[model samples]
Target: MMALAVDLALALVAAAAALSFWRLLIGPSAPDRILALDTLYINTIALLILLGLRLDSALYFEAALLIAVIGFVGTLALCKYLLRGDIIE
Candidate 1:
């Protein structure tokens, strides 16, 4: 059934989110933390869109788009800082 498939997808997304959180919390290096954060952001967007699909609405999709953009920007800034010691110079 479609519902069962959707539920399974949701569970997988949640599990990935949890794993991302764990990596973010206890990563062994700066790049590892950054990678975890990046993964978590992407997973969050996926979950949002999945939830929107499950609910048959477009609201969460917009928020997910916003999060996707912002998360990319955030990671870019962090990477810039890691590389150059400043996000704005």
Candidate 2:
């Protein structure tokens, strides 16, 4: 039952990641693309943590945490650039 649950959860995350990828490819606006990338990052992090749980390893969890932090920082930078028209002025 636990394995089945994990499979189901990962399947859902995979679906979310696919949808976000499509959005990133076809989004009309820059912000839309950025948002889609943000969603993809979140899904990736979740998937990594789930895989860690299934494999009984904490390294994947740490990698997921790092990804989350990097993703958040990148998103913030993108949003700032979009809003202010400058990234490092």
Candidate 3:
């Protein structure tokens, strides 16, 4: 059933989120942490989309889009900082 599939997807996404969080916490280097953070953001977006599908709402999708935009900017800033020692040159 579609409902069962959605439920399974939600669970998998949640597990992925948890793993990313763990990596964020335990990463040995700054770049590793940044990558984990990016992964977390992606997982968060996936979770939001899945939740929207499960709940049949538009709000979660909008929130996911917002998070995606913000996450992208944040990731860029982090990478820039890592490369140049400063976000703004």
Candidate 4:
């Protein structure tokens, strides 16, 4: 059933989100943490999209898009800082 499939997908995405969070917390280096953070952002977006599908609403999808944009910018800033010791100039 489609409902069952959506439920399974939601569970899996939630598990992935948890693992990403754990990595974000326990990463051994700054770059590792940054990668984990990016992964977390992606997992968060997946979770949101899955939730939207499960709930049959468009709001979650929009929120996911917003998070994706913000997360991307944040990741770029973090990487830039790591590479140059500063985000700007």
Question: Which pairs of residues collide in candidate 4?
Answer: none
Q: Sort the candidates on TM-score, descending order.
A: 3, 1, 4, 2
RMSD (CA, Å), each prediction: 0.9, 1.0, 0.8, 0.9
Q: How many backbone clashes does candidate 3 have?
A: 0
lDDT of each prediction vs. the true structure? 0.93, 0.94, 0.93, 0.90
Which has the higher TM-score value, candidate number 1 or candidate number 4? 1
Per-candidate TM-score against the hidden true structure: 0.94, 0.93, 0.95, 0.94
Q: Give the lowest summed-lDDT range of ten residues in model 1.
A: 1-10
The candidate with the higher TM-score, 3 or 4, is: 3
RMSD of 3: 0.8
Q: For candidate 2, lDDT tens digit of each residue in 54-77?
A: 887889978988999999999999
lDDT string, candidate 4, 29-81, tens digits:
99999999899899989988888888889999889999999999999999999
Over 46-83, each residue of candidate 1 has an lDDT whose tens digit, in order, gives: 89988988888999988998999999999999999999
